[model samples]
Target: MPKVSRRAVLALSAAAPLTLPAIARAAGPADAKFEALAKGWVDANLRLNPVGATQVGDHRFDDQIDDMGPTGRAAIIKLATETLAALQATPRAELSRANQVDAAILENQVRSDLWTLQALQPYAWDPLTWNAVAGGALYNLTAREFAPLDVRLRSATARMQKLPALLAQARQELVPARVPKIHADTVVGQNKGLHSLVDGIVADGAKLAPADRARLEAAAKTCKAAIDEHQTWLETVLVPGAKGEFRLGAALYDAKLAFALNSPLSRAEIKARALAEMTSLRATMYDISARFLAGKPGAPPTPARPTDAQRQAAIEAALEYAYAQKPARDKLVEAAEATLVEATAFVRARNIVTVPKDPVKIGLVPEFQRGVAVAYCDAPGPLDKGQQTYYKISPIPDDWTAAQADSFLREYNSLGIQEVTVHEAMPGHYLQLAHANAYPSVLRAVLSSGPFVEGWACYAQDVMADEGYLDRDPLYLLVHLKLQLRVCANALLDQAVHVDNISRDEAMKLMTVQAFQQEREAAGKWVRAQLSQAQLPTYFVGWEEHKALRKQAEAKWSKSFTLKRYHDGILSFGSPPARFAGQLLFDLPIA
Candidate 1:
């Protein structure tokens, strides 16, 4: 992943080390000062958090697992507190414009970390936090070949050896009653993944030198036992005792959203924008639906002066055409592979943006990573030598009935998959992040802005539809508009579910009735909204910000503006927040 999923960005999670920022050219005294501090902090943080270091392509501390107790937290707190004080003391104007953007990213990220650890204290209440670190550390070591197999296996073994101690720390730290039921339940389902990672690494032990193989096997046995122990704890202790509220409530939600977006818009502003976008998109969807069903035998009449019910019925009827087109349940991976090629050809033919030649492939989403999201673009870390990115899709669980499968397939129908492909690959994440990694500074790359990365993908979807992808099929455009409507609902749902005490029934109605999402889609999203705070809004917020920036670019660049040029220019800077990227694009004040 270009940036670790927001839900997994905890201190011990398989997240990027909260490292320092990058330097800019022709730096001033303040720039030089910031550079020195950043360098010191990056080196120290990497030393402190080995799993993060490994994932980011640093190999120095591969054999270590992060210490998970008060002692480890103390070290990170000391580092961030000291660094943040120094950063705040340095006046923002003293740095170059480029440096100022990185500085802002650094400050915001560090503050978020502090808030998570010191105030929110999720480690005590969130079982998912423990599961992430336990699973992510081993997964990172084995997932890519940043080092040789034997070398990586040894690192994995070392981490495996520490699994029991880490679980023990979890048991000691976590308060059962404070653990949210969803979190406890989710972790119970995911704990076995730890065993899977351990077993996979140990299975490869035969390739290692005799003594090394011996150590690996020994570590695996112990790790497997620890995982089982943890699984038992999850089922018997955490799940039964779990009673904490799932919502973040207004105060905590607002604070995290600020740190998450770093955009100028506030919670109220995002909600208002979402409400307006929802109305406008529904109107557009209705128009497309009307065109699509104009000659249908028994279509709902979409009168020019239609009531709200008329518009709703027309759009719902039109969506049946999309829902009717489905890929076979067994052929999802094959169908997505085909759709990817088509998407790539379309982007190249239309010159949507500079399409990257970076190697990307379709793969099944790892079972452990399956529950939270349907798909993710798992790009190579900026530091990794292996350049392949996997566009992973979750497979239907075998336990699901045909009805459940049908609901899911309808939501991700043939055209919908193509739209998703456009968002995850082609000129979306794979391409955007390839450009992001090429930026000379790894500062922003170390801790990319969530909105910038997610925002670009959503914008890519808009670009495809605007440029008449799929032969300008109104049905396809209708599909895109349908998904776009969900984007708006996401922003609204993030606030409503957390801050406004919105009931589950209200959220379902908002998605299914208002947004027109499938029952399966709405249900999964409800769980996702509860699991992730401040992240659901990234899609809508990013799309809005990206659209605004494009308009600005069109006005400023005038005759010189082209999609290729605009895309390349904005992405030239590493993935900072979208507004910062725009500021850099126009050479405006970093403020």
Candidate 2:
């Protein structure tokens, strides 16, 4: 089969090319059957979630958004099931080695989506997650951070026109009979952000033409009504029934693990691995604490036994320090700009890899989407060539009390701050994603593997550390360790909350005791674990995979390898699943 060109897939979905056939050809098929299968797969995916195109900077179908109603639900599941069956039936020998891997990757994605919908059965009242996703999608469409202003507004107007229908779809699709307690509480929290988004659109209405303005206003009104109704449902039905349990239980967790990870490893195996890593990380933390406190502290730091309240205060203080340096928010963005410049120079100085000249910018997080994550690097979708990449830093809320703000800051102290910069700005997500967006095949970019994205960012932390960043400042190193511990805790909390019948208290205890998380920070983590699924674990998992792959490649290239060459070589494969990176680098089968 001929390879599916990036242009063709974009033409079909307006998103990047995500055809499995293009990727599958590397596995070995020589007939038109592959192209048909690939096109079919792409079409099904685009139809199931039209918002996906918006996220990727594609406005062709921005007017046709997913309703999130039963019709949409059934259509998606049908697509996934059918795709899985078709992919499974393909002859193994017909796939080229790379296509075999791509086939497997595509199959895993379909299975993951289906397993999440069916086994987790979370389609009830988790409006919080839905609202957050929707807000992010809209912000991306209107912000013009990725595409030109006029282009974005046109797309936003199209989406805004369908807003009411989409919300109504959500209301109808949510199973009132089975609404989960935790989901209800989350929806309540998520609404806090969604309401803000409505405000943003209304405030910016002047940007639209009169006709477009009318459509946006109507959409905004409908969205407001839907949100109000959802809130009412939460208060009357879901909250009254709130069980406060976060996890779906063991059996479902197992199914989810199989689907989400697409790896042979089971939840139990991941748990065991996480536990072992926790033990090692804890020991390292202790060693670092001892060294830092040695000779200077009044009392030889005996695990400071602070109350949960006190711990929360301390965490906020750390976050404050991390964020408060000389420049305010705008200046902070400038710092990010400087950091990226430094990052590119650092790599170039060492002759490490080619840095694309595509402009990267730093910006503050837009208001409507402020609370979701502290920072994120927004790279243009594959179809968005030569556009700016934004490193958005969400500001601390003005409404927060001084104490609350203080606690938040402490958690992100200098070292933590630097690690974050690396992850979001420098040699991490921003840089890696920039390369990924330019990958030859749009399909891979659209169907990007989560592990590859999160993992590369996580691995970049260690990459900078190993390159003697901060002069190996043990303090910085210690903070990195703490950050690593947080990732580990996330992996554990995700499982504990959903599958192991772990109570809130138990989850808090694990974070505070085992992970040294402050109470406030732990509480936030609890919410995050509830709202997102199968994603928190990727940071550590991806890091570990990248580490292993890098070591193997180093050994193989031995005398011939330069750090620059190796770094470029590793990333040049365009964010294939990490396993594929190893295979391609070592000339092994895609397995």
Q: List, in order, the clash count of every candidate structure.
A: 0, 33
lDDT per residue for candidate 1 within 1-591, as digits (tens), equals 233632233111122222223435746788888877777777777777777776666778777877768998888888889989999898788888887887887788778778888888887998777777777778877776667799889888898898799998999999999888888878887887776778788788999999999999998999899988988888888899999999999989998899889888999999999999899999999888888899899999988878999999999999999999999888889888998999899888987666666567888876566688888887766677544577888888899899999999999999999988888887778777777776655556677877777888889999998888888898899989898888899999989999998999999999999999999899999998888899889888888889999999999999999998888788778678888889888978887
lDDT of 2 by residue, 1-591 (tens): 000111112111111222111233333343245546766776667655666665565556665666566676677788889888888788755766555555666777777767666765555645554564466556656555555555566666666556656556566666555556666765665665667767776778777678877877777787777667767866786677665445566777677655545555567777788888887876665555555554653533334554444443443333333334433322456555666666667765655445566665677776544444667776666665555666777666677776665555555544566777788756777667665554555556666666667777887887777787767776677677777778778788888777777888999988877776656578777876776567677676777788888889779989987776666666655666788867876778777
> Can you give the lDDT of residue 306 in candidate 2?
47
| TM-score of each candidate structure, all chains considered together | 0.96, 0.85
In model 1, the Cα lDDT at residue 244 comes to: 92
Segments in model 2 whose C-alpha atoms lie over 4 Å from true places: 1-32, 145-151, 202-204, 241-245, 297-344, 364-372
RMSD of 2: 5.9
On TM-score, the leading prediction is 1
Quote model 2's TM-score. 0.85
Local distance difference test, candidate 1: 0.81
lDDT of 1 at 100: 85
Lowest-sum lDDT 10-residue window in model 1: 10-19
For candidate 1, report its TM-score: 0.96
